[model samples]
Target: MPPSLLLQHAPCARPTAKRTASLFSAAVLASKDGGGARPPRPRPRGKPRFSRQSAIRKSFQQEQVVFSTPVSPDPTVAVIGGGASGLACASALAARGVRSVVFDTGMHGLGGRMATRAVDDERQLVFDHAAQFFTASDERFQKLVEEWVERGLVREWRGSIGELEAGGHFRPIHSSTPRYIGVNGMRPLADAMLPENDLIKVIRPSWISKLEPFNGLWRLFENEKPRGQYDAIVIAHNGKCANRLLSTSGLPQLTKQMKRLELSSVWALLAAFEGPFPIPHNNSYGTFEGAFVRGVDSLSWMANNTRKLFPFETDRPECWTFFSTASYGRRNKVPQENIPNATAEKVQREMLGGVELALGLSKGSLQLPFYTRVQLWGAALPMNTPGVPCIFDPQGRAGICGDWLTGSSIEAAVLSGISLGDHVADYFASCGERPEEFAIGLDDSLNRVEGHDIGQFPGLDSSQKPQVAEAQLTATI
Candidate 1:
């Protein structure tokens, strides 16, 4: 994520309409209409050149990223982290006759940070606590999304978005590209990708603490105990987790590089109001799906989860997730689950204060949510990344893949997984040890993806424009 994720001003475009949305989840993606390509290079007189931090507002800034591995053979593989990257890797490998077992902490269920909170009470209400929607422009990902659309697993979110400025002014945001969300909730999208008794196996509520070697294969340990053995392991997770796991797995060089990829924290609060959604400061749109707020320290994002769902309803109780800025989260981070700097009620009031200010409501106008839950992500917004697509060690027969490989965003996550899986499959095929029914193929689009150990590769020709666009959307809250 960009260091200026929380610092986009009028001079810089935001992610939503180039309205920055790093606070929404661990990774952020910009819409086609949100932040477009740099307008024909040469600036308009006095306008400053958009900084890399500002470049992040653009969703696709394709880097010359490549995933290469010097590996031997693999049949049973272990994929850690059940997020977008991990699941996609497993799915690709499974289709190729490679068997993999996925392990995750599952704090947010099978989707990792892509989660939804199903509020329990007399009335059923759900809040998309993370990753409101994702954009698919790549051919392969577009094909994958098409299948999901056909199965009624996802739907387009066509509602108009707005940006909230420092003065509380709100304006309409128009975009050409469509934003898609899960049919029921984001979690269902991940749940639907699970294969039945084949190459993919899911182990949830599991924290993989370490990895060890026995004989020729790898032994995975959960909570400090040996869990299973596998021919290879994929570290599909954040940089911190990857570094720790690699450090213990006897890969010091890789661990040191991973440790350099830093990330910031965020606090996501899920709440459901009793009345209709809150009106904007100027009541501009009559209703809106979401807003990217600037000049507010307490809150950076606010979304009406119900409104984002297709067939927008005029009358529906508002349910939204508020994401706190890195500064705010760091200030209020609890030492323990029970021990806290402030009482629960006090924290709730402070969060509500940001909402009320954004909506131009008077004191206490925002009602207390009937259902409320707070979650702290120590590694929410990615700060710096390796941007190498994926990493592998043939001698160790292990590798790592995630959004961190190419900064943080949904697109990065998907591409990273696909690239890693391809290398793994190719490694097996080269060793003449892969299954005969292998279906994995590296065609034209993949050749466009090139990666290295250090320094950004310059392939800024017209052909690589889409990839550059894809890499441009990595900002934080």
Candidate 2:
């Protein structure tokens, strides 16, 4: 968002034309028609007449009065979505000395998709039923992760293995260098990036319905109510929300492109057990009766409610969350009513011989706890189509940045944000002054920079002298 200049005073006020003409005429003359000349009429009483000198002085003073121009205030950025991407953008803006605010529709304290749910009536246990985990592939991101680790905001999952079910083709488990998780859940990472109460403001249970650019400022509306205005806006949520807002602004071409994109939905189940889960704590994956599903190792994913950081504990044995693929979601006709938890439970029961067996216990082993919930992820993953730009730079003023812009991963989102942010910075620097409200196509700029490959720093490239395996390990990790 670009900064705005504020003008405290209105432009110089002008005098009425009648007043100006009267001052200029000074004296009124009477005309005699077809007869002898007539004498001048008396001027109106109580009205002061202006001398020629006074009139000239008044006009000169008016000409000399200068109207001050409004100077824009420092750019105040508004970020929509309290997810990782939104928080990251806010943090980046803050680091640049730009103030920002984040708005989310989720529960006041909860973060999007890194959501947690309670299972029992007593509200004893909770589980993270949204994003399982995230990975970082950039050095800058890694440094941020290190800080998170130091502050105990996150912890490494330690063990992550991918197995191909066919022919028992299992590759040796390659531990991710540092797969991070929130101390309480994945929400902490988002929370950490946001500013404290005084610095950054987070508005929850609020959703932006429209964004209108007016008089060099963006006005955000919530259900048609005027929220406020900002110098710039960052739409960090899914494409659907962004598209909806952009569509209302009468941008037909942008609306058409946004509508072309598709999204998928998922059904997740959160269950509590009376004893240790039957599956290994590390996690497992396979197709059960044609249903492509994943049974997460709650332990590896840090799904323990007993931890002090988590909301609930008590004597509950364990809590586990299961997820079904988008394909399965389509086939089962999962109704909107039975979102997330319910859908998760139904799928689990169908594949694993009823909910009781899925929890690795008898029907009467424990209370059913919480009802199932379903989460519909519109634009969950972007389908990579041929000829699609890695980043769509339609209007230089606005650019698309998200996991969908690059690839599906936390790293992709971060990389896309950084790239787009850099592009915007460069564009603004080149402009030298505030840009007019219009879309400037960057087709040529993108073409010129295309095909550039990222290179590793010196001493980091493989072509250099080989080092001891341990030394390499320390450096690489």
Candidate 3:
């Protein structure tokens, strides 16, 4: 079947193969008994067994060579931000026989928003503080996710999640769409996706403060110290850091495009309580692990971290993470690196009050948490997007890829990174000449999906909505 025409079939077809084998063995045994038994039932038809042939796989299969030889030999790339997009870009480039170095500011590990906090207290508390979970809608990303599942690095998060209305009404989100998370935590998944080869080098706990173009190469610097130069550079992060780095990078067009992205600040509150919330729910959908709070100013989301990790383990202390609304975050914004004690206490009080309202509990009904923490995401997520897969500057040999470029999701960041890697590989295959299709995302005529928030937004009634039409994202790179 044509790649695009292939339909997604149910995963239950594997049992049919086992059934057919049993029937064939039974027929042999009956034949040995003087053919007294009836012939075996005919093999079933019309269903394809589980297959690994995704659209992305088929596209590569059609090509003469999966990894074409690059015209420029041994070209090195510098990828800033070791998040999903940055790691994915490095992986893609490595597959094409190119080398890359990834730079990140993560003190503990990589996986920017796919973060986790492990408390050293005796309670053995762990929390997926940032992105709760991710869904794969694109074929390319689906293929990668499937591979990760087989390798035991990722698993489906089947926990019950839905909307928590203002008056404490719990409505489960009714969708079969699979939600995925790392086996240990979101950060490990990002760590696993890093290419296991010498071609990809990672420098963690390092920040690239500036980029200087000198003699046809981009030189990266960390404050006063110089981090080696590279033939090409890919900016795989957004927000203030990216803007400041690009402002003096000598790439006016790319800088202009980067400045167009607007990000929203968000506050995340993590607390460990002695027991679960006393909210009532139907037993059919399972215990609520997460919820998107609606009509609540101080809170926008809440999830049970302990339940998400061990859904059946009821004896453990319940750890819940809450997120403040964009507007609330803006109003109560504080310095991220060093938040004041008074501000933290106020935010905790107000957000917990909001949580009480979401659960319809009386004031001060909930018990004090055993452990509590507050973090402010200055550039939590993008408010809007450019609706492009990625942005690249051929003349400056620079590119930008992130969830902010396409949509607010881990899948978007992966897709954008892979696309830019392929685009650059194609450019090098042509011997330093820009290909006819310089960048597919730069084409304005193509019908592309607009950027949509994967999580709760400022004004959306529904927890999440489908990606808007092409008209919604009219901004061009």
Best by lDDT: 3
| lDDT accuracy of residue 266 in candidate 2 | 43
Residue-level error in angstroms, candidate 1, position 243:
3.4
On the 0 to 100 scale, the lDDT of residue 327 in model 1 is 71
Better of 2 and 3 by lDDT: 3
lDDT string, candidate 2, 1-477, tens digits: 112111112122122323322322332111111221123324326633322221111221121111111222233456677766666655554443334567888773535665666655674665666655555666766777677788888776543233222222222224435445567766556677664423246788788997654443456789877666554566666665687776654334344445555444444555565654333223244211111112321111123333323334445545655444445444554455444665555565543333333334445544543333444443344443112222322221344455544444555555555444443333333331433322332221211111101101121212123222111101000
Better candidate number, 1 or 2, judged by TM-score? 1
lDDT of all predictions: 0.58, 0.43, 0.68
* Top TM-score hit: 3
RMSD of each: 18.2, 17.9, 17.6
Better model by TM-score: candidate 2 vs candidate 3: 3
Residues 1-477 of candidate 1: C-alpha lDDT, one tens digit per residue: 111112212211223311222221211111111222221122126632222321111111211111122222224578988888888787766555455778988865787767877876656678777666666656666777777898898888777665665445676556566677788888887777665434466788788887765444466777756566565778788645666776656544345455665555566778877777556556556777666655567676677787776345646567787776657766776642474536456666787788787777777866778777776666665555555778775545567787666645565677778777766655564552332333222110121222211112222111111222111111221
What are the models' TM-scores? 0.73, 0.61, 0.78
Clashes of each: 27, 17, 0
Model 3 lDDT, full chain set? 0.68
Model 3 poorest ten-residue lDDT run: 59-68
Q: What's model 1's overall lDDT?
A: 0.58
Give the alpha carbon lDDT tens digit for every residue of 1-477 in model 3: 002222121232222323423433343221112221232223326642211321112221121111222223435678998888888888787666556778999999998888888898888788888888777777888888888898898898888878777767787876667878777768788887775546577887898997765434456789856676566889998888898988766665566677776666788889999977777442344468888777788877788989888777778899888888777777888889999999999999999999888887888987889899999888876666677888876655678888777667788788888878777765655555443346444322222333322242222234456444321211100
